[model samples]
Target: MSGTLVVGASHAGIQLATALREIGDREPVTVVGAESLAPYQRPPLSKAFLHGSADTASLAFRTPAFYAEREITVLTGERVVDVSPTGATTDRGRHLAFDRLALTVGARVRMLRVPGAGLAGVHHLRDVADATRLRRALTGATSVVVIGGGFIGLEVAAAARALGRPVTVVEAADRLIPRAVAPVVSEFYRQAHERRGTAVRLGAAVTAVTGERGRATGVLLADGGHLPADVVVVGIGIVPRTELAEQLGLSCDRGIVVDRCARTSAPGVVAAGDCTVVGADRLRFESVQHATAQARAGAAALLGREEPVTEVPWFWSDQHDLKLQIAGLSAGHDDIVVRGNPDSERFSVLYYRDGALLAIDAVNATADYLTVRKALATGATIPAEHARRADRRLKEMLVASLDA
Candidate 1:
């Protein structure tokens, strides 16, 4: 039997291999990862792992014995430098032949290019190793300045604050997580972080990472103001790892272009995870849910089976005691119906586009999140008028809509 070579050894790569085996495809499967450690959960790296509440062993998705028993070959510490339709070559000078190729090469941390960015106290967290180094640095850090107000930056600030280190979050935009959440939701998080003692500076443009003697001392703003810090964390964004896809002549627009089935431009080559943009809309979800779902679809595509990607995208972030859960994509929404009161610290914001439900962002409101997620998945939606009534539960509203 021919083999399948999965590149990147990420969440998508491991899931694709496991999906193939579970679906009764016994062909040889090999997963190649650049990291020396086995495939592990990444989300916790910023929260639990960084705070010392979780360790490397606790972050693993599966044990090495599980892969061995399933006859799946996982090669760590090897990077696939070259690829083609039939095979791939690793940086270690090893060639692996396969009938099917899956690319799950995830994104890397977008580096800060300002002066002193490469100083001794500057760090970027994208993987476990980065988190480990940051965690160690946090031990002696008197103050931290996180350059960005996205999920990673906020989480890192929360962790640092929990460690008794004074923390400050500087966002280039007017609000936090503007690209992902609605304005109301963004404001809520801004206030939530501020209430937790983390200083938040919005509309702040970073000019450079100020340093003295090759060690970061703070961040210099474009306005000529400086924020003092012993440690500087850059959580601006990430760029997709699309070099291999482009090298293989696949269509790439910001990210590797793929169809609903995770099929790339070249036949026998499929891609998934943070490295791919799906459909004509070019929608790219960087969460674990998208990675695993798209990987399963890629697995089916490899076996010549039909498995259209049809899963509602959901994501969550834990900042201190705040649990923010988001369902569906809220971009292009014309109106928002806020359920409950934001001041209560437990509420949801529902996004609507021309009176049609598009998405929902719930904070410390898991039931509302699950209800909206189920409604979106099943093609059921509550009317805007009905959604405005905060007294009524979303589950009740959804059931009423379905009955009507």
Candidate 2:
């Protein structure tokens, strides 16, 4: 059947619905979004929008009229609580029967289970409302203590520092963004934030949040030390919303397991976004790019319009004036080549495994960023030594074939 049902109306879900329609699937397209608001870009929720640099209208992925015009039915403010083998059930009591089901339910903010974590000033950044509340909290906060030294926390710290607020970051890891970046990249971030006067407490596990009158005032470290603050933002990570997928008995491990075509274990069921593990490479990403790509690909799978999914995984982060772009996945890269001058704040790091170019991490280098992205997309065979030097133009080297 050409009819498609996509759940979780984030970027992935919305993208699937649109793609299904675009690909000549004429049947009804139902998109279930947990958030009442339309699908929006989440990366800005921690940076530009929190800093009053962007409006809610600007973050919208699609207009309400666009969905209506496309004949796409979007069930907003409805949570698909259960997904049986045959269909999905919503919170407001609606049974959705589907010919093909797509799970694009992204992820949710993971809260720390520490003492006094439920304090009034303790905020978590994930959705638009959370960012809005945090922005309001910033007005009266003289000091801000952020837990988790990930991108969101650091971005929030930057915004608070810009407002002349004393900011402190408490991370259990020895380095910031330990899970995401290499040691050198983490060091670069440490130097950058420290230069901006952000107090970083590395290897500090927050045991409790000290509060007065149900409001967070400070955080007690595992060593019984306290870092005083008027506001707290938690950005540890996210957990995939897999309950519905699990209940439906779809093969789920970490995320709903799907093929390169985005089909779940069960027939007539597909999965996408952060909620599904798609690809022969066993990869799952919560980023906007992955979500959108997976959704479109899943739509194709549902319509039986098989096109080889050749999209490279990509992610980006906006920190201060630096725009970091990563092309391809670097899960098991053994060799990393530092390209461009780090001193110039415009560089690209090439990650390779067994001589195959795996990923490129670009920081403010627009030209090299495009070059490496193209190289990875085209499966170019480039040698490791040549990728490391700033003077060696990768484009020229590629033209000569990577053997040189």
Candidate 2 lDDT tens digits, 290-398 = 7777777788888887654577878888777778888887888898988876666788888888888888888898777778788777767567876665676878666
lDDT of 1 at 348: 91
The C-alpha stretches of model 1 lying farther than 4 A from their native spots are 399-403
Q: How high is the lDDT of residue 383 in model 1? A: 84
TM-score for candidate 1, please give it: 0.98
Clashes of 1: 0
lDDT of each: 0.92, 0.83
Cα RMSD to native, each candidate?
1.3, 1.9
Question: CA lDDT of 342 in candidate 2?
Answer: 69
**Model 2 bad stretches (over 4 Å):** 279-281, 399-404
- Per-residue lDDT, model 1, residue 41, is 92
- Per-residue lDDT tens digits for candidate 1, residues 99-145, read 98999999988989888899999999998889999999999999999
Q: Estimate each model's TM-score.
A: 0.98, 0.95
